[model samples]
Target: MIMYTAGDVRVEERPDPKIIEPTDAIIRLTATCICGSDLWPYRGVEPADHTAMGHEYVGVVEAVGDDVRNVKVGDFVVGSFVISDNTCEICRSGYQSGCVHREFVAGTIGTQAEKARIPHADGTLVPTPGQPDEDLIPSLLAASDVLGTGWYGAVAAEAGPGRTVAVVGDGAVGLMAVLAAKQLGAERIIAMSRHPDRQELARFYGATDIVEERGDAGVARVKELTDGLGAHSVVEAVGTQESTMQAINSTRPGGRLGFVGVNYDVTIPGIDLFFAGIHVEGGPAPVRRFLPELIQLIWDRKIDPGRVFDLALPLDEAAQGYKVMDERRATKVLLTL
Candidate 1:
């Protein structure tokens, strides 16, 4: 949004993003989305004014600069929320999310519009097998953000066979986290959701347990399901003080806590963590690192993350999509160009 407000997003015509560097490439957005994280910016929690909005996108490349090589014109691609060049040291280390020259492209590259200019095109965008079928677009788009974030949470939390995982929050990210944990082979997944709709989807996505409580009560319920030892891994998808604490407390001693929530004022109690001996890790999930494999899964129709999107709108109705998500009337909203 060019202009920002506390409860609303305003869309206006502005300069279209173009290749500004040799590493840049421009793609015509075929599908883009309003991410849960976008709520933070829309609520005036992030620097809003004069910033472009959106990051997740599925599109066909329109042009590439001199240095761009990994992608080509007419190639259908899915871009990561964060931009990076793939050849960097960090990218090779499986941490493209933390690339040395990583740039937050949401409000700048702005996938929300009809066209987006991607910096470090080689690293930031992954080409799909072919022009995705109509039904595959949404699932592929989800991989660019929510699905990727959730998958990263599962990976970070060490969700796998014989392990019990607890996820805090029931938003799109949280619900997707449940799916990710299940796909990662977690024996049991405890999804913390008070919303009946979300809880239902959690089960569809492979949640073995559903806890309707929050805060300490939720943690207690999680422990109850895990033989009073707490979950082997905890995924924190909500970037709030309460959710963060729940994730931390729900993990057993020496367990891992994978948090993808964008922390604001949420503080981790040093003393409590010191005593718990929990291994806490995660920030902005390096979704790009996992895009190739995730894309393959979607292309094969092996997993359907499109289920998380409860609302869909055309690009012109972008404002309404934001309203649906901000008011919690919808879990995730998909915007079509």
Candidate 2:
């Protein structure tokens, strides 16, 4: 799939990818998904400039460079959106997304096609325990991005036993954060959403409460649930000025806030954060750090993260996948090859 401009995506035959670096690998994609970040360009919030689209993918390794040791041809693999050498100081420090030798997969070549070339293959790709069942493909594919991102959000927010965790936004990431919070043993999980379908999914993901309000009213509801002390942790999954403030104000003083939303026109007020006395930590999630554990959970059928993909289409209808997601008609769209 290629994006010539906002709202204009096409399925065209692109040249087959080849191993360009000693650490590179070529993958034949079995599954890919349209991410929330992809909407930035789809809605014209960011420039497309005829760029290739898609980052989340699960596929079979077709070939690997001589230097690649961890993965080889015919291995069913999942990789992070950001390629990392996994030996750089930043990557070793658990920030692979910001590694010294990092390159975003979408910027180089798209996965929403028959094939894609992955750089730093050994460090970036994780092989599954074995070939996954047909039904498990969607869940495993989700581990490539959204599920890992939400897990990072919950961890960064310090959601755990005895903590009251509140999540802002009910998108795929937010819903996944609810699952993470539940898995982490959060005492109370409050999901703020007005959409019935998402609210149901949040509840299924272990959200104990729901706040149908937004902005200040939503913040008030969260405080009320927390006995006026606010929540112990807050996950901000919608990147907007209002959502950011909602997450900040909904947390207790000295609490932590994890923001994983793909920020658009967002600006954080220095004074408000200082007075709030909260610790905020977030960026593109270092998905590589969590891939192993997440893969195991999916393989064992402990979590069904694929529930986020409400729409599935063949690769040829890539444009429709973008359309439904942009219009909020689908929680997430899965493209099958």
lDDT of every predicted structure (CA atoms): 0.89, 0.93
- Model 2: number of backbone collisions: 0
lDDT of 2 by residue, 148-234 (tens): 999999999999999999999999999999999999999999999999999999999999999999999999999999889999999
Clashes of each: 1, 0
lDDT of 1 by residue, 214-317 (tens): 99999999989988999999999998899998888999999999999899988888998898889998988899999999999999988999999998999888
Candidate that scores best on lDDT: 2
Candidate 2 — which residues are off by over 4 angstroms? none
Could you tell me the TM-score of candidate 1? 0.97
C-alpha lDDT (0 to 100) for residue 244 of candidate 2:
93
Report RMSD (Å) for each prediction in the order shown.
Answer: 1.2, 0.7
